[model samples]
Target: MNNKTSSFLWNFRQLKLNICPFGSTSIRRLMKVDPLKLHKSKITYQSNSLQKPQSSVRNFCQGVLAFQLEGNEIQKRSLSTLTSTSVGKLLNPRPLSFDSQCFLMSNTTPQLAEDGLKKITDSVEHDLSPKEKQLDFGKQRDLIQQCNSMSDVLDVFSKYPRFSCCNYFITMWKIAKNMSEDQKRVERQLLYEHPAFKQLCDHVMKEAKIVRLQQLMFTLYAVIRIGIPQNIYLVQVLLRVVQERINECDETSLSVLSRTLETMEESKNVDALRAALRLLVDKQIWTIEHILTLQTMMKCIGKDAPYPLKKKMELKALKELNKFSHVNSQYMFGALAALNHRSLILLNECSKMVVANIHGCPFWMLMNILQSCRKLQYQNLDLFTAIGDYVTTTFDMWKMKQVLAFLFAFETLRFRHIGLMNMFLKRVLDESQSLNQKEILCILHIYSSLNHFHECKNQEFLEVITSALNTYLPKISSLNLLKAVYCFCLLKHFPQDPFNQLLQENIINELLMSGNESSKAENMLHQVNACLEFEDTSVLQSIPITLKECSSDSFFSNVEVEDVLLNLFENKRLFLKNVQLPHNYFVDFELRMDSKRSQVFPVSEADVFVAKPDILRVALLCVPRSAFCFGTTHPRGGLGMKMRHLKALGFHVILVHTWEIKRLDMNPAVTFLKTQIFSQEAFPTATEFAA
Candidate 1:
């Protein structure tokens, strides 16, 4: 395509995107002018369809996207140029134009500014909470919106002493958001020393007691969007005020406020936010009426939100899923993400919705659905194949972190579509220069987890990761470094010369002394040592950490399931309980039989290890509900790996998921076990023994 035609077609792609500011209004092709040279190229709106009733015409800038005013609302539209720079970079973030307090909810959404903030809607404007309803003074909002300069903003607040905290907040954001970054950062500067900012903070703090729910919510939000210029006092005050009036917040305001808290990077503020949000969820969750409100509540609860709160939300979400047809696709997707995968019914219902809406989901949303599937351990290849077909074509729009997340999810689910894997790996290779410490761990983990030991496909990435890790070794977390070493062992491609830096005294001690990971770290040490012994090519003079001798006994997470299985074996001598194996692997029960495998007899869990019982071992793994992913019956990566190693060591595995015991009576559970142990599928290896 020629440069002119290419630029013209780019407009079509933008118009096609639902997130685009122009809607369907951009590609009407009302008029086309001859291309002017370089930056002079422009598209002017001449048609009445582009104009608002009783409003003046608005023209778009030639090379940048700008917001247009129509009626009482501000709308986003397009103007394009085939410039040297890309269209996304050419656009600038629109200034604050909220009818409510959504601005703070999206600043940390991992999107560039131009994505969605340009078009604010009026739907979320809360009815002023009961206490502040009397302070809705006349014409204040209109006059403030009309102000064109900072001086005008200051003058309005000065004129109206009765104006509520809402007006005060609007003025603060208008003035402070426009200030350039350099002005805010210097140690001692005129902007920092200015009294106007201090005055704004003082007024908000003064009126905080009677501040409308709207203003308080947005006040907390604005601190996240653009921190108060030299005003930490305002943040601390806002937090204190939140605890007092937190229950006064309506459902939508509460959701927005909770989302804004996730963007707070400071640990101190995060702890406070978690405490408040958790308390509020406990108090208000029972009273929520609207389904969309529930959806917002589910979406706002971040990964760090209380665990019991997450369980409560999932129970509420599953009840709300019957109303899924009435919900928006985005809201449904968001609610579906919070579901615990223990319910196949929920996963099945949600997957139907997912497949139906798969083609319409954007790049990030699709990737999020996949990540949720990974977490849920939902390994329906049909769902994955459908998403893979769509996302593989729109690969260019994916951000680096999203790409890393998508690849990691694919590997975790153990669903290796050849084309999808190739596309993700190629993107990683193309963007290798930008990999950070965590990203390098992700890349290496994806590579090894998928068992991509091929020298040709994985060689370049390993070389890049090795060079990157050597630089990033000290920077990576102790947990992640251990995971990376485990990945190295999985691939058997550890670069001896560079990664020997992993065995440094300080690093080894950090790995050994990982507090919460003390038990797991011992397993990692054994894994690395086993790999080192097998490879027989050590750059290190000796193994770094000494292994402590211990019993190889595996314990059951759900002991009730074991009791049920024990009843099935009527003869206690027929089942060996909790046999621990090499490399931290454990089977709940093991049985040994003759080589012909005619009859099974119980061997002592200890005595079986004296001989090669893995050859005739009929291993029964009692996977708890938590061991499976959120919705599917499939075991998660960790348990699946244990089962895989058991099979590789010559055991014919018999599986028992917790649902079998939970959903079935003792008779049926016994029947299920007999079928699993006695009549195996023709292709047992091809089953979901790994996933």
Candidate 2:
């Protein structure tokens, strides 16, 4: 009998390995079989004369078998080390042969050891009480695999205690749902509404004390993926379990738990998030997955990580960066960008890796890498050019928003790629119908920023936008509608007919609702444009003179003069007298332009003279280029030609330097004007006029 039990368990070990790779470990630990002792035992049958001597060995084998079959807590405690004691050492081993191996592998179900082994397995299962039978991990795992409905799965859960097969059942549920068809998935969707599901949830919540750490993590992750709303009680229990076992979790387990918590959107849970953070902060190195999870956690907390933690993460990332495929690198770069990490060296290294792997990279990943570079303001011309070149080739493959998002990235970083812009415009024109209101507004914003309004020369693009306006304007949000109106004004063009009416109506209401004096002034300009389009001056009397001051100033006599004065008054702090030159150099001896007349002066095809405003005595010249760029060739072209003449006429030539625009605050011109208006120091000499 001892020999029979030893041979049976050995065969069962082989079968268990074949059944489940993970289950084999539990089987080995549970059986406590000594391979060396089994190998030394000689095969023998019970002889009639020696039956009396072998009764104890038979009784020992029967006692162990009975204990395993019952698997009750009391019996388990009593026979804790029974297999490791002298009882297990009495096992009899048999020699292995090809015939026996074939039989064990192929004929495992029935007639195993010629009915003797079958009797042992049958007796072990059939003789157990119903409650003890639920401890059978193998049978429960099988039932979970074969589950066809939510009720079937819930039934399995009901049979076992909360912790017994929670992990395995949840995993199997995910696999079934993910692998099922739409109809089958709909069938499984019933799980969320099932009463049994609520019962199971309540069970876990009430009995969370019995759960293990891995089981808790797995259960939470499964819940998140299934799109169930988590119970607050369950979440509290999970966090408590994590707090208690924080020291016992290894790096891999910690990474998984943090990622699971993030999926749960519980990163804002102060206690739980900090517990995971403390464990991960000290690690010197990490796998690529851990690097991804660590950065995600950093983003969730939305604070700068400690110096040591950040340095270690960068070091680990640098070492493993080369080994990551493009997808993983996308995750890495995006997470780093999300955390607002500013490691230039690692960014440069990642750029090189991305460029090298550009062929297989998807548009979204490429966009992510570019967006990261834009956010960090990390400039790598080679990296940008590589991605730009790829985008050029694959331009047609991207969707409308993707193309626009890609363009916006470049626009924000001030990296101009003209060819890519052309491709993007062509795609947008072709796919305009697919665009939504938000997308159209975005495209317009991008185009306006790039000064690509000239590309709107395409009649097809114009027609598409014109067509979309009717459908899009009413639905666009207020902020974006304001932006769209601004784009139209910036382009100095509006769409045709009914679309234009819709746009104008929205714009008028938005501007009036703004309550800003400038917004009312802006509305006057739109009205002026409408009146001028019809060549109707009958309505000009209704236009307020103060509103006329905000109109676009243009000098037909001096083409560059219009832009300078327009930029000067753009700050809206001080009013300016628009300067006009004579149509023929001999027609007017002096340049004198009135503010009200200059408002409509740019509309004339021929140059005209107008009187100066009473408040203007100074001439402000805007030099768009830096003084350094005024070389010998173009010396007298921009500011040099105008500076001397204006100063000779006794006007203070206050030059607005366009090259210093970035360094200037919101109202540098305003500040300069205020200083000039109050200061006792006289206007600077002509030598200082080139400022």
Candidate 3:
């Protein structure tokens, strides 16, 4: 108890030095609590003779003035009566890891050993529980894995209350992670919330002296997988354990530790552990032989890793990639994903390798590979098709996350399997309740990108999603909300009454007013685009923000195709360039047909354009290469929406593929234009004269 208390004071004093070290803010944070309680405290301080840097004569005596310490019965005596740091340095203290003890001191020693750390049972001993006597560590681990339900596992725990710290930790973690998908989230939540789990955490806190490093590391990993580790007390203990004993960690442990701290980037507590992990990994990086550990280190450190470290890692990868291609599919996937579009040539070559040898890979790894290829935006048709086939045949085996990831890849890839999407739609609707916000958004993004608003069956899917989204709408970020609205508006449809109610004038005004410049501009654009699509002028009447007219409409003219067609038009009166239509659409060339179905003329020829409402209005669209799928003439979902929107606005939309003008000679282009403008059955009025 004394050693742990001294350790806490020492750490708090160290924190005081680094935190502010000098300013008035220094001591204020440690005692920013109720003034009434300070008056009621029994103990008082006396100034120390020493004049340290941040610790003033009075500040040096601070232990705790009884806010939480009073609750714990910790303020029994004054700090003036407490022993000096030099006297307390004689007591051995608990360390961040096992097999080492870093005692409380004013300063720490430099560069330590890299010996592996595991559990070291303390001197304290107690009689074993009957269940502990029956089930050894291996048996306990096996029982935890074999148990079907949380209650069964609790039965095991209730029987054997005491095991080695590491054994107890593994037992709890295995129980937490091993559950059916239907019960996975619910059961894990219940497990963490259970009294047993709370007791486990409390036991660790009370028995910090005896707990091992692996126990702390695995506890953190379990919480990350199970739920958010919001308990600052528990987290601080684990981090300090690592910080004080970091030098004793092997490269393997450091690699794992880096991966853990990677997620806690927001906390200041893990900074020391993170720095220690980096320093150790930098020296030991070359000795790493396991590909996945190396990949994990690179992934966790990411671009922040030193240039020398990154350069050596890449160089090492370059040698191992060739061997990984033939031996391990997972290694190949990691290699390609880690590179992440650095070399397009390698991306394509590795994609070809995946296509040739993807059959043996697991479904989880295969999903990652597919997502990696999609991320690189370099799709090999065979690779996507092969995996799609494999997933379709074994669709029942894939989890919802895997399905969501697979569908998300469709946003850019030219590939689509109708049967796959159909199965996915049914799966999504049935599992809609289980879907989280991001997962639901991925589904909407995919379907919207495919222009599924026109599909009847997708309506119910949207409804389920809309209902689900409305419940969690306020909790979602601005980017996701905008994305949701964009998906619905792009598809020319939206959701239920509640979702519609959120678009009330005041709500929209608040969104625009409260957000950043980019968010405000984007929200305004969505409002403008939505007004154009649905013709809801009421929503636009009093909008707090306005986007530029051009910003509201994403489309721009394809200059190459437009120029070719403009040169073909003998008279500028025949067509207009950059014409704006009713629904925020930009027509590259707008031509009209006369009453006799013979002549084509620009709107300038019309004395009153509204009078000839019966006449055919043509939107001569110049579709750019980027608007289509790579290596194919198939239009992407966004381009399809444009053409659909034009048709909705009552235009006889005509598409001129950019490649036709860019790739072909003038004579061939002229022939193509003639066929496009005047049908074989129609009288050639402008086509004949233009030729």
Candidate 4:
């Protein structure tokens, strides 16, 4: 035979000789019979060879059945339920007496010994416990009771899972949140690792409806402090409950509810804010904090508050006006502006009160009040004078933002507090380092507006501005850079050398990458206004120079003004193409009038001054849609000063517009202007006609 066939036959013969060859080793051991009995029976079997194999198989099956029955009995009597004495005896099998040993040896088979070994191993494994929870019962209870911070509570929960289900979860968090900052910081670290704390917060939120009002507030306070995830449904549920029981809430409870309402995301459930506002206002027990909350709510609700509700709120403010301090009055004014409510009566009284206490008012509070006045477009000379005097005397104490706000409001009102401006210039010299990028832009904007009346020739102010530009230009945002450059052009203030190069590069980049075309044109005009000899003109190619290109730049530049005048003259129906002109035709035409001779002086200008009459000047204006109401109506500002100067010059000025002519028929508007200018009866009483 070949080697492979020989090897296979030998392996097959060895396998056939082994006992219980079909099953695994353990199974075979359980089924095995005693070898001594089998050997003894072998001789007998040889004598009766035909019945031997069948008789051996029958004996092996009986042995397996007996072992299975004994294993079943052991399982029924589990090791956990057995007493310690039973376990000890089972493990040691108390040194069997001579008679017992002899009986066990005579009956036991290999299958019985294997079953006994399996029972011992199973009992030992089942008796062992986890080491994490090895503490005694009293010690576990004590650890839980003494828990103070999140660390203590979460640690106890880790050891004993049952402690996580206790009723004191909310109470423990309350104590934890009130701990020291250091302790809380440590606890916060632990809170992130354990997920069961989040589960506890969820449990408290779900059970909030059943808790007392104080406890509910406490729960919210703790959750907010712990920085738990905000639940919108829970907030809605709390709001509903508070609304139902609003009458039962005292001042303290109301305050807590208002704070909680403020903490919620404003875009979700704005109705809750409105409801809180109505409740607080109805109570009429106003505190400083309540007023602040009202301001926040007004901002959230905006102009959507009902008219009747607004009137009621106005009445409440008036009723409580006398009790308000400077800060409260400031808040009340700001709230009125945010809600877009007009209360001139309250404003008059509030101003008088504010003037009385102007010296003692905080700088921030005074600034807030001025911001409100600006919003209302109100011009109270006495209030302005008082605040101006205080700011002028104590200019050193004001911050840069405060100074900027004062300048904006004062300039808007046409209140040229000269002492204030001088003090402001001097103070800026000392506080230049404190000026930031935003303040720089504000300064430029105010200076641009003021330059309309007089030139900005203050050297120190210019120097401070140039210094700030050099320090912060690289970090400024693109849009703000455009605005800053525009303001600088208007004020004729440009940075020097390397900073100028950087500004040019940024402007070029912005223009090239600009997505909006209209904004680009408007920015281009400002760039042209700030024309330095060194500005890079390459970026100007992208923008088409056109008038009225953007709707936002409503106030026209010189070029736009000229274009508008040209468009008006081109309309042939007006019949004014052949009128005579003076030697110098100017945009800012000064008229000094008298029956004998004209008294010329520096004064207001007509937008398109065609002819300066001794008693009648025909002036054309292109006022923006917004300026007619809020912008030009300041008492001593642009519109007011123009009217006063026109009257002082003894000129009957005729106002004409080309933009609004589209709304009216061109023929009738032309007829109206012609009649007023040509008819001698039009100036019967030296009248100024505005068309």
Q: Candidate 1, residues 1-691: lDDT per residue as tens digits? A: 5544554455356444412234245433322211111133234445646453122122222323323334334344444422232222212212212221111121123254333222111111222344544546657777688775444555666665445645655555566576676643441243234445456556676566555776787777765564543225466567656644554678767776766665565444345455556555655777776676666656555555556677776677677666665234434544545534244666667767777777657666776667776665566767777776666777677677876666677766665555665677777677777777777887777766655443356677667667777776656676777788777666556676434666666777787787888788878777676556545445655545677755743365556666665777677787777676665566777777666555777676456766563347677777666665334554544555555566666677777766677888878877776666666351147345533
What is the full ranking by lDDT, best candidate first?
1, 3, 2, 4
Q: Residue 684 deviation, candidate 1, in Å?
A: 6.4
TM per model? 0.55, 0.54, 0.55, 0.50
For model 2, how does the per-residue alpha-carbon lDDT over 305-397 read when each residue is reduced to its tens digit?
A: 456556666676777666666555657677677667778877777677778888868777778888887777677778878887887888767
Clashing pairs in 2: none
* lDDT by residue (tens digit), candidate 3, 53-128: 2432223324322111222132223232232232111112122221111111112222211111111121123244
Cα shift from native, residue 1, model 3 (Å): 22
Among all candidates shown, the one with the greatest TM-score: 1
Candidate 4 regions off by >4 Å?
A: 1-203, 210-229, 232-237, 243-247, 250-252, 267-302, 325-327, 375-379, 401-417, 431-436, 452-457, 471-481, 493-513, 520-691
How well does candidate 2 match the true structure, expressed as C-alpha RMSD? Answer: 20.3
lDDT per residue for candidate 4 within 14-132, as digits (tens), equals: 43333333222222112221211212211222233243222122122111111111211311111111112221112111221111001111123558655543443343333335663
Q: In angstroms, what RMSD does candidate 3 have relative to the true structure?
A: 12.3
The candidate with the higher TM-score, 3 or 4, is: 3
Best by lDDT: 1
